[model samples]
Target: MKQVCLAILTALLALTVVSPASAQYIWLDKNNVKVYSDKAPPPDIPNNRVLKGPRGYKAKNIEVKYTDGTEPPAPEAKAASAPGTPKPPMTTAEKNAEFNKRRMEQAEKEKKAAQEEKNRQAKAENCERARAYHRALQTGQRISRTNASGGKDYMGDEERARETSKVEETLRECN
Candidate 1:
């Protein structure tokens, strides 16, 4: 009799646990207070929430109007110019010239940015080469800067040798 009752109770518990009866979520409200519910949160809620769902769930985007009581001062009207120092209104030619100058300045800035990007890429390539040289040196291979027949290049022999030594030191110490 006891075994039969235990089996029936276990079956009932399994049935109840098989599926969720309701979905629930917690969200914040306009005043930044947390709220919990078993259904879709109220539209008046300040922030959206994530709720457990069966495959698909819609996200709620809640916007709140909040204000801190600080306001900016109003703009003051400009004082009228003195009689001898009259203000000149901008003319069409002057405006066009100013616009063209600004456009040219922006183009120059963009060109400089592109040049800097190229320089960075070149530096990265050089670092890769340094790493390769270091690896070759570590594996007991002789790798010089270049053949002597390449002529006097921009990188002097002393500087190239110094750079390679630095790479070797870094590889030995760091790795």
Candidate 2:
């Protein structure tokens, strides 16, 4: 029995030591949402920032490897320090034209961003309003159906109409 126990222990130890760990990379998508996976992105995707997995299985142990794909030649000290570039002088008219162009571009970008935000908010609000309307309808139907007594003990037709109108107002606000 002791020999069998020893063999079992040995087998467990071997299993523990035999399996090696692997690493994985993680990054955010276009929507600024985080994603993690074992595979690398394809070449067509811009910014080939590879997240190098550690020698272990856990993602937390992964290291960020910024391999910019392009090969860099050996650097020379003299070429780096040389400030041979000259800035071109701009006339007042040219400067004003450039400023106006940049202002228009910035305004256009802001407008598009605002429109996208508005659309997202409208969608969320519409969903909420629709859900509320559905719930009210369901509740009203349940109240009306279950109370099948000949006497009018539940909400009258006028009250039901008011409730429906309120829900419609909420939906209109979403639009």
Candidate 3:
């Protein structure tokens, strides 16, 4: 008995769910314009204008024939392309390729700009070093160095001239 009662309850719930799917309603608005919906019309609508739609009616591609014998206008067609020269629109893959190409180009430009900035900083540092060396050369301080044999070697006039020329070359190249 309990199994039978459970089966009856399940059947009742299924019917309630399926009944609304097959039901449709039609009504006229305040301006007498025809409206179709799945739900019942509101209380403000007159009983005469409220109608029961066709059984199991799906709304897609369904045309409404007015009571006054007038049919709605047909949908407009798409514009035609020129003969023999028509180009199809770009596909999703083509659009994505174009976007990636632009993105890569932008990344390359940014990398080049960073490299140029680094080069500029290096040049500035070299220029400062050359200027400092030139200033020391002009100071006329006795310049000497310890040789590999631990003997003190003083720079002669010819050695001084060579060193000055090298410093000048560095200044010109960096500046």
Q: Which candidate number would show the highest lDDT if scored against the true structure?
A: 3
Residue-by-residue lDDT tens digits, candidate 2, 1-175? 9999999999999887765333255554433345666564444223433344435523222333459975444235533655752244689999999999999999999999999999998889786967776587757563343455666466677867777777777777666
- When sorted by TM-score, best at the front, the candidate numbers are 3, 1, 2
Give Cα-based local distance difference scores for all models.
0.63, 0.63, 0.76
What is the RMSD, in Å, between candidate 3 and the native fold over all Cα?
Answer: 13.6
Best by TM-score: 3
Candidates' TM-scores?
Answer: 0.37, 0.31, 0.45
1 against 2, candidate with superior TM-score: 1
Compute the lDDT of residue 132 as modeled in candidate 2. 75
How would you encode candidate 1's per-residue C-alpha lDDT over 1-175 as one tens digit per residue?
9999999999999988864654456665444456666676666432343434334656554444447755533213222333433345579999999999999999999999999999988777776777887665556544444558985445555666676688976655443
Predictions: Cα RMSD each: 19.0, 20.4, 13.6
Q: By lDDT, is 1 or 3 better? A: 3
Instruction: Give the lowest summed-lDDT range of ten residues in model 2.
Output: 57-66
- Cα deviation of 20 in candidate 2 (Å)? 72
Instruction: Write the residue-wise lDDT of candidate 3 on 1-175 in tens digits.
Output: 9999999999999999998786478877655567878776666555666666666643333445789887755432221432433355589999999999999999999999999999999999988988987887778877888999999998887888899999998887874
In model 3, what are the clashing residue pairs, if there are any?
Answer: none
TM-score of model 1 vs. true structure: 0.37
